[model samples]
Target: MTSRIDLTDKAKELIQELTDKHGPLMFYQAGGCCEGTQPQCFEKGGFYPRMNDAMIGLVEGYEFWIDRDLFEYWQFSHFTLDVLDGFGPGGFSLETPLGKTFKIHYRLFSEDELKDLEPVTRY
Candidate 1:
């Protein structure tokens, strides 16, 4: 099945480093004005998802979620999680203390991929 999200090698490595320190983790992508569009990483359950949030998929076993409104805006595209070197403006994302930032790269899905999209879980 075509999953809603995937992760880059850099993101994977960073996730390992973070996991070593924080144990299981989760991601929440907020499209709000203050949070910008960066994905926030929290130790699993650190931040609660609202009813309007969607659990898109997992990144290396860690759940990845997005605001339902934002997911609706980008539902036709595929999301790839990536890591950046510098800290991002995301408030409380675990990576900020380590000089790292989590980001997403998007591309519209192919006709075939679109036909087999995985279902999203609502919070």
Candidate 2:
């Protein structure tokens, strides 16, 4: 099945590095003013998902989640997780101290891929 989210090689490497240092990790993507729009990387359970947040998929065994309203706005697209070399938008994400930032690049899902997309888990 097609995944709702995928990570680039750079992102995978960074995640592995972060995981090695932090033990386990998770991602939360929320859309709003401040740091909400930029995906935040946290140790597992470090950031709690709201009641309707969507568990989109996993990256290197780490759960990737998005705010319910943000997921609604992005439901028709597929997400690509990537890393940038400089500081990220907000200083709250785990990568901020490493002089790196997590970013999301998205594209609308194709007709066929949308039909058999991996299901999203909500809490």
Candidate 3:
């Protein structure tokens, strides 16, 4: 419902690549070490739970969805999504809606990592 997450060109490219290989992309927020939520992106899966308030968007043909709660959190703050390519091969940095920044590297989820994820639809 909000346009708080600004996707960078690099981010778009990455999402496109994933979508090309898979189908749709899934992005969500989960519990993390900090006060803010941790952003997680994955390939589309079947039987994703329905969230009436999720924010959905398309980035270079890849569809992305953010939980309503996360969307609201970003909307009310100053969070921005930026692609960082200088930190030893770099990755993504989420400038918290509150002005705090968190960096995440690009890596495929292992079988173990996938266990905790819930399915999100593909567009």
TM accuracy, model 2: 0.97
Candidate 2 per-residue C-alpha lDDT over 1-123 given as tens digits, one digit per residue, 9 for 90 to 100: 999999999999999999889989999998787885899999898999999999999999899999999999999899999999998778988889999999999999999999999999999
Query: Scored by CA lDDT, what does every candidate get?
Result: 0.91, 0.93, 0.44
Model 1, 1-123: lDDT tens per residue? 999899999999999999999999999998787788889999999989989789989999999989888999999989999998887875589999898899899999999999999999998
lDDT of 3 by residue, 6-102 (tens): 4666666656555566676665543333433545455555324245445444445444455565544443332344444333111232222223332
Off by over 4 Å in 1: none
Number of clashing pairs per prediction, in order: 0, 1, 3
Q: If ranked by TM-score, best first, what sequence of candidates would result?
A: 2, 1, 3
Cα displacement (angstroms), candidate 2, residue 27, comes to 0.3
For candidate 2, list the clashing residue pairs, or say none: 51-123
**Candidate 1 backbone clash number:** 0
User: In candidate 3, residue 50 scores what lDDT?
Assistant: 43
Itemize residue pairs with steric clashes in candidate 3. Answer: 78-97, 79-96, 79-97
- The CA lDDT at 6 in model 1 is 92
